[model samples]
Target: MATTVRRTVLTLPAATVGPPNPLPALRPLDETHSLDERARQGLPRDMARQIGYEPLRTLLPVRVLDGYGRERTPTRLDAIVIENERLRATVLPGLGGRIHSLHHKPAGRELLYRNPVFQPADFALNGAWFSGGIEWNIGATGHTTLSCAPLHAALVPAPDGGEMVRLWEWERLRDLPFQVDLWLPADSDFLHVGVRIRNPHERPAPVYWWSNIAVEEHESTRVIAPADEAWHFGYERSLRRVPVPDFQGADRTYPLRSEYPADYFYDVPAEARKWIASLDEGGRGLVQTSTDILRGRKLFLWGSGRGGRRWQDWLTEPGTTGYAEIQAGLARTQLEHIRLDGGEEFSWLESYGALAADAATVHGDDWSAARAEVGSRLSEALPRAAVDAAYEAWRPYADAEPAETLATGSGWGALEVLREGHKLPGTPFDESTLGEEQAPWRELLRTGVFPEPRRVTPPGPSLVAPHWRDMLETAPADPLAEYHLGVAQWHAGDLAQAVRSWERGLELAPSRWPLLRCLAVADQQGGNAERAAERYAEAFDDLCEERRDDGDSWTAATVALGREAIAALLAVRRTAEARDVWSRLRPSVLERGRFRLIDAQLLLAEGRAAEARAVFDAGFEVADLREGAEILGEVWSALTDEPLPDAYDYRMRPQS
Candidate 1:
């Protein structure tokens, strides 16, 4: 494919490690070389090279490609891990900004950032199995998927004294082959780590990826990206009460703002190449440029909260934490119509830059050239090698395990459909059923990653069926069973019942996601708008914080949630009271194209269809989601007596 821009189509095709080193690059994997079904499900390798059984097979094994379009060694690696499926991996090569910390301050532990093998994968990763034999498996889709989160697994050759390959990530044991991808192209600008799974037969196939990172707050730590300025503003997904909406900008589907404790999971724009930059160098500042295809011009800016953990007071403790992520394709696109085509592919790129040291920092005549070279090399090197090595070290998976075997013994359903990009803000859930949904943080909490629990709420669905409830009561001191039982209650519908169960579970674990969101949503349903709003927003934020378009956590959270407390109250004609809450919330509703529909409704309810029309901009301020968006068209037709919906993006993904 040719591009009008010089930078769009990259040409350099070798991996760059740290600095003066170039690793061999590989070519993309074709169907023949890719793993088959027998391989993906833990089926024994055709040529067993071990003394024991080699579980996990690969039907759709990860395929790697180098800048020169050559296939790397080992072909593919099945076991992998990732955060945002959308970012299935734009994992560049090398390990330059590599950070490997021996976390022994609070306790003795090790953390891996971009660490390469100078430290050798041959050590007791700090007395913990956190980092060991590590490898990367890049695939075609640059992000992870719902059914198949990017696979990051332990590479223990024969489980004996063989080399250990362990990548730090959140994952559940599954016998399915999820493709892994890495981007270490010859002329690459950044690194991407992603995963992809195309199985049209699986309806409601989801993107199960997210954004997460272990964190420690400091002045240099700040994040800036293109998002709704009011995102975490007054009424964001998170229950974290900003107690105010300080957002000031044009409203949009996904406004631009940053510096907050957010784990967001929103969708990629239809024209998904919008720009988002993160600072702190790595965590210092961020700049997002949403390109206007028409004008072809970009506006950029920076964000800094001056060491404030999050733009909004997420109020989460300063320990280990994850970042924001997305995991979904452009579902609402025309691609959904394609059959088992798994044709809906999502692609994007991420570039990391270091603060060029303000004028006060730079000196010397040769500085400019030096900096540029460093930037060029950095922007190139390590990432390339990292991705190259990842690709070169590939192996297809083979799973003989049945679907039943992969099913969670204590999960919500026999087979839960993959959840995708964020759903609309969900309804206030029943605290009783706070156990239905599975949280990505359960293991993180249990593994002592979070020893001191903070004060925050997670939102969304929580139900349980009678069978699970009975089992919970009979189960012995099985915290795992009890906790899941709480989840089942939430999924089954008894919100309060689930909450009680989870409450008990929390007493045992102290760190539960259901308690986080359920308590907050319950608070909302119970009538304390302030507290409810705070926690509800917090939960939403957290969910978003961990989602990627390839894995829209926020969207699902919203779909399950219904509407914001303030919006719901306003819907009930409690305008005056809602106005008060709205004042307290100070939501950047004006900046949210989605909420404009709400404004039109709120105005109409107050007998201001004329005002509503004005709010609808004579039916011009339209967005996506056809049928739903048409409600306004109907209302507007009645008011200005005009028809619309023809101007919205009513996109939809295909069902299994």
Candidate 2:
């Protein structure tokens, strides 16, 4: 038997190629229809306030990204195909500037999952997101709100060799600028992607970045990453402790045969190289490598059960098959938000390549061999050892933990699946069953990382009751519209009108206990002290019922509801009831960090200043709770003659 050898050089962009596929049209949501699930469930008062009491732009405008999911004329766009002798890749510059297809010429294999048609689903932090290819998530978290938006892309010459595609976008939400440069040298089988993020604002900003790579989920596929433990979290950002590669005492390899849904975020060994690869039955697949700046990796599974099929249908087109997400993050994990100093710019490099190996499982050292196997000439030119040495030298300063067992098991199924070496049988949840999906801010709220909203003042002259009222007229069944009207009325000082609006929202969706919480707020401000406390207690009980039935406290909306109820109880001097609520959530609060702030508040309410200070002091010791400490420090300093140490004055990670 003779060993097959391959060789090729870089090629230029082809002016003429095959014809493009037809863009499919998807129904877009109109004013009569809303992408918001909460609107139908009765919008909560606090959520309405969080959203600025204004209507949400749930879907992207039409004519963007092949005009899918919106009513817009389809514009003809050209796909830029960058090819070398051994590899050919196509990028759609107009469509989020994603790599549409990557093909390894020798094996004639598609390295990345190529969605045949463009389809947007309601899965992102923003309402719309597209599956397939690699989506760049920068600023905010969970599939960036801009996943479906178009990006500025241009072809530029690489300083080293060959041409590179540069995708740049100014993230409006975080007021940060982000750019991704992709290079494919002719002699190398790898595609180098370099990313740079900048906070040009005067004030500091929270930063998050993740590269979501989609690959076909095959029966024999396995994912390999150098990590001992995984930090798993559910939709609500509740981190769970589980073994990476191993789940439930069983080694659950990739292309997981388990029929249960799974999502795990792995924190690799501190000194391990950052790389994850998905291997096919023949040990050939896509490998992604990055510097230590991007330190986390995530594995997501849609499962292979009946429920899993339904989830697939819900998230993508009918014919599209199941896929796995191998994501790389820039921080400890997505939920652990990082702060970038004003005007500070951070940059990192990531590489994606296709390689074949004979081993069933690939390891850290395998990456070097894989690179060499892909292209010996390119491997020699790049010199893997030198690059690895450089990455080892510069480690970013970050607070980390060793597999904090935050939660028991993956939220998708039973813990038995982890131990039994097989996926547990269950059905995937539908949208209605999923319940209020809000961004993760429970810890921030509970820990005082985010300041509570001020008491409602008399509605200012800028009150927008008419605006909300008009929306209600158009969307009579829209609970959000009705809720917003109440908010506007409350701000406008029409206590009775505000109460009526919220009541109407509840009447439409009685399950919306959040409306009750809001109504209690209005009642308190309206001088109905006893009624306010009653409503607050009722809201608290309702949330507890739901949480108890679900066995999860990670729901932000529920937390917000409970927080409001407790705050209202405290305001009305119902200390006993507030204590009961706090008692129920004590364990979760302690595990999550936010509730500790509430505990401190309760102590202070009881005139235990020293105890309150101790609570803050203790929390400040944990890396995750440092922000909570700072907020408490401010309060402690204001209330007591004794000031918090200077350590609280600045962001300092206690010397480990």
Candidate 3:
């Protein structure tokens, strides 16, 4: 670890640039009332809202404080475009080192940050100006840890007397670092936009970074952002593994929507979907620019694998998911970035989600009525010429061919990457260290049944089965060695043999998660829902205990099996009866956590579409879970009365 001191926590020098009007910066619609006064007065919020304002209030159960946490005042810039109060632009510059943090008060669903890298424990409330979900290197925790939120951001003032829309800067922390906010110009209907990086340090600094952004919501949060169209990946939707890239051409626009169980990358189109637009001072504008830093810098986006619920595919079914979370930041298990010196700054590109809903969710045919309602209201708001130019500027980059990458191989075979050494989040193994227990480990892969050596480890239980003759004897004995051999046999389509293995393993070690997982799978495969659920319950309990020591495993970021177990019970129509069990293990899903998944689920169940959207919108108010898909799935399923399955196979399989 670097012995770097907190040279400057966060210094905002608004005096040099312009006067700063700090947030909730007292305004007409949104005001900068102190947290306590807002609480006393019960401030009504409508920032990310469009539909039901009342439902939206309950959607975000945040705790607003009297004042923001201890921090410097914002540098208030003069309103350059004070043509009118409604059509004015206020700019605040010289925030060279002002560290913005989330306050505990005003606890909205979106205020999911507690502190910056400087303070890693004080989780913040979601929503507010700067949500502190910054990106970290993949190997920081061996590809399991994800940089999902933001630490700080800089909303740059537009040169034109337009709305200061573009932001460029990031949280400056010596540890857990990212140093840039890469967003597009908000006042694009006016002029060209750009930002300057002020590297004050003497030496060049290597900083790994990316932007944690939340676009305006609409009919759906699903987006169409492009990294490079020609990018390919190793995507396994069910196991929660991200797609590893295989770029081939220059540019490829990928249309990423959470319609089905997708783990692959597709191309983004040059055409932009008319998004749900805000009729502002000028008018409706299609000026969203979504881009990433991967093309030029070493950055990537990782799907959040934590946040409880086993990182379950709760919202993965067809036509249910939403959002196009573009991750050109870092791979799940690699360096996100390496700043050459202490003063270098790298920024990713931008993307705009479509606010132009073509048809009503109920009608799905035409936008004639809605279009006519506000046809030419704010033409001045859109800078068509600038938007066109941005599209053109991004064209050379967006439409370029993907970067060509050759697949590497080892003598053991190209498929060797799927070996036991291939480390993952919960594998409980070292990636660089290859231990003696690899044979049986591979055997588990070969067979679907548990290895004879009970646990995946080598020096485990050795439960001999009826088909023990197939096993070769080794000098050293393993307790669960018999289990691995059985699993390998089962995966090869020998269920009878797999059953024999499980029975034998049970004789030695009656309760085990892996075995029960296999048993539940086997039962499901055999069409025994009752038995599968029963065994899965046991597996869920065992796995929970096993992962007790692994904080990340059960972090508020990933879902736990016990949670799934409770949900599964409810899904079986146990309903009220199941609520009791659910309430007991409900801290992860119920008690305070990061994003409000349970709240989203509940809203969906109540058949409140607008409320559901508000839930998702507020949940993303702090950090974008890259979960537009899940949010859509929950609502879509709840509306259609389809209890979405917990797994991807269920999402992809043919419907009855």
Q: Summarize candidate 3's per-residue lDDT along 536-647 as a digit string, tens digits.
A: 5666666555544424323321233444444555445544433443454536335333225544554444455667555544443212223222443545455456554343
State model 2's lDDT. 0.53
Worst 10 residues of 3 by lDDT: 18-27
Off by over 4 Å in 3: 1-479, 482-499, 538-559, 586-589, 592-628, 631-656
lDDT of 2 by residue, 566-604 (tens): 777788778778877777764544444446667777777
Sorting all predicted structures by TM-score, with the top scorer first, yields 2, 3, 1
lDDT of each: 0.29, 0.53, 0.30
Question: Model 2 TM-score?
Answer: 0.50
Task: For each candidate in turn, give its C-alpha RMSD to the true structure in angstroms.
Answer: 22.4, 21.8, 20.8
Clashes of 1: 195
lDDT (tens digit, per residue) of candidate 1 on 388-487: 3433332221111111110112222111222222111111111232243344223222342211223222232222324334545565534345555555
Measured on C-alpha atoms, candidate 3 has an lDDT of: 0.30
Against the true structure, whose lDDT is highest?
Answer: 2
Clashing pairs in 2: 10-186, 248-418, 248-419, 446-594, 447-594, 459-491, 459-492
User: What shift in Å separates residue 148 of candidate 3 from its native position after superposition?
Assistant: 10
Per-prediction TM-score: 0.30, 0.50, 0.30
Please identify which of the two predictions, 2 or 3, would achieve the higher TM-score against the true structure. Answer: 2
